[model samples]
Target: MNFPTHIVAVAGLIINDDKKILLVKNPISGWEFPGGQVENGENLIEALKREIEEESGAIANIDSLVGVYSNVQSYMGWDGVSYTPTKVILDFIGRYVGGDLHTSDESIEVGWFEKENVLQIIENENLKDRARDMLEFHGKVIYRVYETKPVYSVKSERYI
Candidate 1:
């Protein structure tokens, strides 16, 4: 048995209402987006929908592509476990269409946080800035790649 490696993508759904961002506390990380590894045979849009729904128990309507980032900086190396970052993520702006808002075992807590109050909930400044960037695509989305080395790239998405 083997796990698929390349082309594996995860996604974070950014939902904002009245200038507040919806963020969830990951069971491992303090708080971040509700996302997971994209399984084989699933498209980007489908993976985003399933991940967000699974973690937050809410159905989100796809709004637009916000950005993509690496999950390397947030790896969990518990009990002296060696960690290697290996995930490419696509971030999107998902709007809450319907469904209950509750936290799953994958999360510790779930709720929306404002820019000013995001610090109290999420400790990662990088993620906070990314969250802010989600509001406005900045005319481009940040793409960081980590293979034999780390590379930073940018792309302009027609949607965001």
Candidate 2:
């Protein structure tokens, strides 16, 4: 018997007291919230905090889960010979606690932006959609199934 394996990641839509959102700019993804794949043996909340700090030089407290998304589309890895694993992403709402904002090796730019301006900074459609869902979150947790390859498309969505 084999245990199912997937690439698990965590992201934070962190808002400061000024209502500004934390954002990071990477070469590949353009602009996005701070997040990355979870390492083995790392707790999800720890991973979220670590990623936020590492990518944006900010300390954030995980407030609540905003959504869970699955990218069913598999793509070729950089190696080109092997396919990457399916991705399961946990998106959370976070409160900015402290620390000066700065960019890390993974991020070329890190700063706070007005909430209304986030969508414009994020160039990836998939991320923009997720940001919309997060920004529109009232009280329910959103669940979405989507594919990204030839084009990004949503297979299904649910408010939980």
Candidate 3:
């Protein structure tokens, strides 16, 4: 049996001195954590740092891995063809080190939001959940797999 290719991505839950979370508004995902697909030769931590810098212009130090989430859905690929792909995102808790706040080409806006406002500001439910999970993270890594589209269902979950 042939299996579909999966895209591995990394996200940073950067908390600043003001106790706010950094967020980026993307055309596709709305207000979410700053991150992107891992490039060739880049490990998860390297990709996370690069993505956070590229998307939010912020420097961060990854403290720990918060969780791993899998979202399987159909979307338009770079080739302009529709494909069902699994997006596996590794979320990490990061401490904001320094750098000016700026948005990249992939982001419409970049700003810090209070933890209480994340759910209301972020349009994606899954992303909101991820944020909440990261905020409440207690040194344990979470693993979650979801089947999206006709119905959003959790396939599996565990704490590691």
Q: Which candidate has the highest lDDT of all?
A: 2
Question: Which 10 consecutive positions of candidate 1 have the poorest summed lDDT?
Answer: 151-160
Q: In angstroms, give how far residue 94 of model 2 lies from its true place.
A: 0.5
Report the C-alpha lDDT of model 2 over 1-160, residue by residue, as the tens digit.
Answer: 9997799999989999999999999977799989999999999999999999999889999988999999997899868899988999999999999998888889999989999999998989999999988888898999999998878999999998
Per residue, candidate 1 scores C-alpha lDDT tens digits across 1-160 of: 9864444555565555565666788766678766677888888889888888888777877766676665444343465676545566677777776677788888778887675676566665555555656655655666643322233323322332
lDDT of each residue in 1-160, candidate 3, tens digit only: 9876889999989999999999999977789999889998899999999999999999999988999998977666657777757799999999999999998898999999998888799877778778878989998899998866666678889998
Per-prediction TM-score to the true structure, in the order listed? 0.71, 0.96, 0.90
Ranked candidates, highest lDDT first: 2, 3, 1
Model 2 off-target regions past 4 Å?
A: none
User: What is the clash count for each candidate, in the order shown?
Assistant: 0, 0, 0
Candidate 2, lDDT over the whole model: 0.92
- For candidate 3, what is the lDDT? 0.88
lDDT of each: 0.65, 0.92, 0.88
Question: How far does residue 134 in candidate 3 sit from its true spot (Å)?
Answer: 0.4
